[model samples]
Target: TLSEIATMAGVTPSTVSRALNPAASHLLSKKTSERILALCDHVGYRPSLLARGTATGFTYKVAMILHDMEKDLNAHDWNRITCATSAFLQESGYSLVLLRTSEKGTSMDMQVSHFLMSGIADAYITSPSMLKNNTLEMLNSLKSPLFVICEHGVPFPVSDGVLRSDADAFKQVWSRIPKEMHGKICFLSTINDNTQRLLTNIKRAAWDLGIDANNAISTLSLARTSKVPAMEYAEAYHQTKKMIKSFNQFDFVWCISDFFALGVKDALTECGRCPGKDVFILGYGDLETFPGVSEKPVLSTISANTHEIARNMCSVIMKKLDGEHTDIVTVKSSFISRSTF
Candidate 1:
């Protein structure tokens, strides 16, 4: 099969081998490696990782520990990160193995221990939440090359990390609103430690911007019992309707996520309130516009730069695997102003 691939690529079998090898791939010309990789992909030829590991003592597999794989797989940021990480890893002749630590009855310690002992993967990439548990301890004790993606909060000192400026991004979004609307702002977010921190930061920003932080800013936290993504939309819609009934003074709604903002917009329209004109709404996570959904209101939100995050995350992991020290990387967020807010 290697010979066949080499023949197709007009290279020798040894050259094909080098192109497919993560460590040795750097020896080959970029053009040659890309051509050989294209042929391999076109032919659907996957090198046996087990065999290669046995021969070279490297699995060429990278384990990705997700917070909650099922729920996060549907979420916009997680989906984009997964795609970008997979693409970058593939280019480096590595494959990704996903593991969920939040699943019921799933022991993260045992899973990580098994991988370490069995040589299932050479390096690991995980969410910051894993640092709160014994997962980080186990990985550190084993001296594994670990890279963390700081999506929620500050991560434990691992090898390196990719951090997001969530609070700063929120402040940026808040600052863009008209000063008059700042006094009538309502924030909708999930009840979590990280969100509580974000809420505090938002309040601080409000005070700094001369908005009445105590009386003007209002907040509602949704219970985190459901993993169903659509439940977020439903809960947001229901709460917006209830907020309208109880306090119809607020003129702006800032949701923690774009999905929730969509629900808030729907509720406003149903209640005979114009989203942009009567009550502007803002959301985080600049999710892609859905296909065949042109009539949906355009949401002004912060783009977390999921693609760049994933790229840098993988880059840091690769550097660690190559015995290079890397520092924590912070990716800035940008505001995407749309029709809604």
Candidate 2:
């Protein structure tokens, strides 16, 4: 088919090959390349990814390893991050492959080793939650570059790293609180691995403003309780209502997620406190645009800017591919104003 297309376009197989490869296509003239491409299209010729990879020693696929593979993929933040990553990579002639740390309770190290040895991906990307000792060993052994994305801006030893600083986001929301309400700030989140880090960041933000966090910040973790990712909304609703029944002693409330914020808002209202007037509420991970969520959300929140993070990740990968070194990148979160605050 290559020779046939070359012949039809009055060119040699070498020229046709150059035209087919995106990186090498620039070597040919615009007119010649267009002619060859148009002829190939006319004859319904499609290049095989496997064949191209075998010949060039590159699969053009990036593997994104996940820590909690059991979590629902339909969750808004997960969906946004993955979709944005995939779309960005696709623009640069690459594809994304999702690999869970464990599958059916199998060893994560073994799974990671298998994928590494198979040589199916050109590069690797992962978060701190998914990084393991042996897994890091395998990734280090490979010549392919590894990129790390820190979801909560945690420090890690990596040449290429991207940090989406939840601290900055929390700080932005904190500054919006009225000065009088500084000492009455209440934060509510479900128990999870990153809860402490998030809490620390929130307090650190207040401390940076010369506020004594010990006296100003109060935290509740629903008392050692955890909910599945999908059922967080209902869990937050019931738990928050119970808490409100006992005590409501805060001028400003900040939640780890929009679901929790919504729960707190409803609980406050049902208990005779107005969300905007009697108390102020803020949340993270803007959920107004999420599927099955209300378009007209009343809660003020912070956006993680998943699309921007995806672009930066791809930019780092591309730089590595071009034999350039990049420093750690920190993307700041932005605040979205709404009726609640």
Which is the leading candidate under TM-score?
2
For candidate 2, lDDT tens digit of each residue in 1-341?
Answer: 89998888888999998887766789999998988888888888967988987887888999877666545255567678778989989877889998766533368757776787787588888744466323455566455778886756355757786778877666777677767876678788766535777778888887887777778878777743555545666777778788874337788887888877887788788888998897888888888767557868788998888788889988889888877878778777888889998
Q: Estimate each model's TM-score.
A: 0.80, 0.86
lDDT tens readout by residue for model 1, 235-313: 7787778776643677888888887888888988999988888888888777645334355548887788888898888
- Report, for every candidate in turn, its global Cα lDDT versus the true structure: 0.75, 0.76
Question: Which candidate leads the pack in lDDT?
Answer: 2
